[model samples]
Target: MSTPEASAVSDEVTTYIANRIGFIELERPKALNALSTGMIRGMHAALDAWREDPDVLAVVVRSQHPRAFCAGGDIRFLYESFQRGDEAARDTFFIEEYRLNHAIFTYPKPYIALMNGVVMGGGMGISQGAHRTGGLRVVTGSTRIAMPETRIGLFPDVGAGWFLARTPGALGRYLAVTGETIGPADALYAGLADAYIDDTALPALVDTLRSEVFERGVDVVACVERETAAHKVVPTPDTSPLADTRAFIDRHFALPDVAQILASLEAVSGCEEAEWAEQIVGVLRERSPLSMAVSLEVVTRAEGAMADCLRRDLDLTRTSFAHGDVVEGIRARIIDKDNAPRWRFARIEEVRADDVAQMFESPWPAAEHPLADLQG
Candidate 1:
């Protein structure tokens, strides 16, 4: 085996090859490894470079931050871009970010994501692709994952709807509308994470990947499975509240729309899950009504391949920025820290179905769509 030399892929990302494994580390700890346009481009470039490199049999994505694998996209950057009327820059970020997501989804080799902490929004976009690509998504006790875009008046983008929709029963819809934060046990139960390793053991796992030798034609996935299984932490019984509330979630979330879902939750009475339903109702009330409605539609429609979902995500991204409450959401939640957003609709019932339908309509023509090249 040869000693590996690390090289800077960009200011926020680093790439290296060691022991037949390629490693990409997110380096922006100050911002909790938020994905900037540059980071997205750098990651895509690294994957493209290693796609056919025989020496590199697999790729591992991790972060330098102790508190986050990646928080999400650079929302503050997008907020400022919108403030400055830099539509091109704002549009380019989503375009490139979604393309990077597509690359990860379709990567031919093993792509492992060490999801240690704060995997949300754009973070979920990058890491969740491993589940479908025959790769590994390793979570830790510190991992706190959510697609909490609805909280910020934005729908979950970056193919989240696709994966969220595939979760058991109506868990996807419940998560999409309420933007709940779930721990590792729930993540595994929801099919979002593959293994739960103690956070303390992550370094040893990475070291093993970097130093262990393998015979010819050895299975990389199995090698990972063995290493991770050694450190996997079994959850206590009934650890996942998401699992406990599955009946309530499925009953309400499977309704025809967000309005009916909330109404059903409000009507819950004398049941063991009543408290959970009420809490979820309160969460939905705070989120942008339009965003919740749009997200419900997005998750409901995300029934096909990842590529198709990415295409629709791009469309929603464009529409959300252009005509939805995303700008105000970011303004209140991130920029101002005011924690009060004057949403487009004061109540869920006020959100018009036509407005939600308009978001799914692409601004660009079929051939001219930015992600049109992403085929299933």
Candidate 2:
């Protein structure tokens, strides 16, 4: 067996090749592997190097953190940058992050993600793209997943508008607006994960990848499938709570806008699902009204290609920083820990249609857009 020479791609990211498999590991345990600009660049650089390397047949990504695969992006960095009036820094981070997401989405090799623990926000950006490219997304019982951006005054970005839009029925809209956490069963039910294996089996799976021999024309996905199936624990038929509420979720979330959805939920006062409806109402009430409105618009309008959704995200993010409630939301939630965000609109109904329309408007001309070079 050839010993893999591990190299630090960045302070927080490490990459190596063993047994013809490229491995990218997130090492920022303190931050739950929350991505920084440097980390994003490092991961992308490793992928780019491995993309055309004939010796490397597949790639796997995992986190060194025991509690999280990746929690999200470095939002504190963005908040601090905003405080410092360094808009350029914030813009650069999003631009590079989105590019990395696109790279992962379009990678020709089998890109596998070991989604073991907390996977949210930017975490989804890097991992969700695997589904479209014949990649494997492995989840464990401990895995907890959510976009959870609307809670902090941002809509789900980092190409979420694309992937979330494609989830089972109106489940994507439910996730986008509520920002609720779901476990492995719900993740699997929602098409967010490919396989489930015991957390104890993860190390053995990695060992298999390191030790197994791969002849030319080997099926990497099948290799992973074989390893995962060895330790697979089939979930109970009713394990997914999300699946149980699918009809209820679709009924309310399929409405035209946030206000209508809230009204529908509020009107369910004496129904069998009243508690769930009331809980959803409470969640929506706590979120930024403007963010919910913008999120609905983004998810509903997200169509065509991944690049198109990413481009739309970029535009909305710019507008969000400029005139939306993100800064205050961050202040209340992360900075002050107050949990009391004074959103621009007192109610979802007050979010003007014109304001949401302006968010969708691109800051730059189509030819001059930052992601113009990105293709479907």
Candidate 3:
């Protein structure tokens, strides 16, 4: 929306200003703007400055890459750092990353995320929080969003428990375990996206936003919505299996436990939608058992404010780093590319209730917790 700032350009993220709109563009087009530690830290600094700068009336976030706002975090770098025993880098990445996410969630100014393309994992972490917190979240036709952490031996962290718990029906559980992709329409239907703007129209939309005037008493999100309405395209027909299977998903995933959820799926394996049930069953069977178990607990127990979920996730993430299926899953999915992770538990049934309970334990005292400052 804005011209590039002479002083704010960076290798991964660029910041600029035009007509009171501060723009943050993901600059790592090669990595699909996958977030690195430096990128998150830069965002923190930029946001801190913009939040105070009177010239900046609003903020706009998009990516230089036409194909992806952000694919995810730089997981390969995280994997290498973990393998090298550099816990500082890994911990710093998560700590600062989560803090930035919280800042975006609670930011007072109008923060707009033009989610143009592949928004997943850490990408979802940053943008989804903004969306949930009354920010301007616009998705384009190129948008393909998901929380595919189960595939990588991770639960949906980054306050996933908070947002996913709020999705329609059991769709959150269905998405968390299956790693399925959803389009703009589905994203809006599921409340993960606010509006749909076609990718081709973004330049004009950004220009309009750049030149738009803002007043102190006006609602910023509503103002953007009204401006974006002219360019909003009617999304194509909904063919997402998530929508079609909602009844089944809500019915089965309503169960509290993952093992029971599997049993519920198996119970319906002989029904009219037997193939669909079996297919989902196969998906669950393929994911990391420990991740599946912990994810269920996180989603089910996520019943409070966003800060509450993040605090819980902080514990889950730390425990996951110590003893969960992350290393093996990362090895198979990222390091080795084998797609064959030897999980600590062989099956969903093998993942005990106590195993999940262990992951929820706070590693630090409540007063010393990294995310303890976040208030509802």
Per-residue lDDT over 40-89 for candidate 3, one digit per residue giving the tens place of the 0 to 100 score: 98888888988878877777789857989988888888789878998778
lDDT, candidate 1, 218-328, per-residue tens:
366677788778764546414577887788789899998888998998998897878888888889889999999999998989998888888888888878888899999
Q: C-alpha displacement of 46 in model 2, angstroms?
A: 0.7
Runs in model 3 with CA error above 4 Å?
1-7, 216-223, 231-240
| Predicted structure 1, TM vs. truth | 0.96
Off by over 4 Å in 2: 216-218, 232-238
By summed lDDT, which 10 consecutive residues of candidate 1 come out lowest? 230-239
Whole-model alpha-carbon lDDT for candidate 1: 0.87
Candidates 1 and 3 compared: the better one by lDDT is: 1
Cα shift from native, residue 354, model 3 (Å): 0.3
In model 1, what are the clashing residue pairs, if there are any?
Answer: none
RMSD of 1: 1.6
CA lDDT for candidate 2:
0.88
Residue 124 C-alpha lDDT in model 2: 95
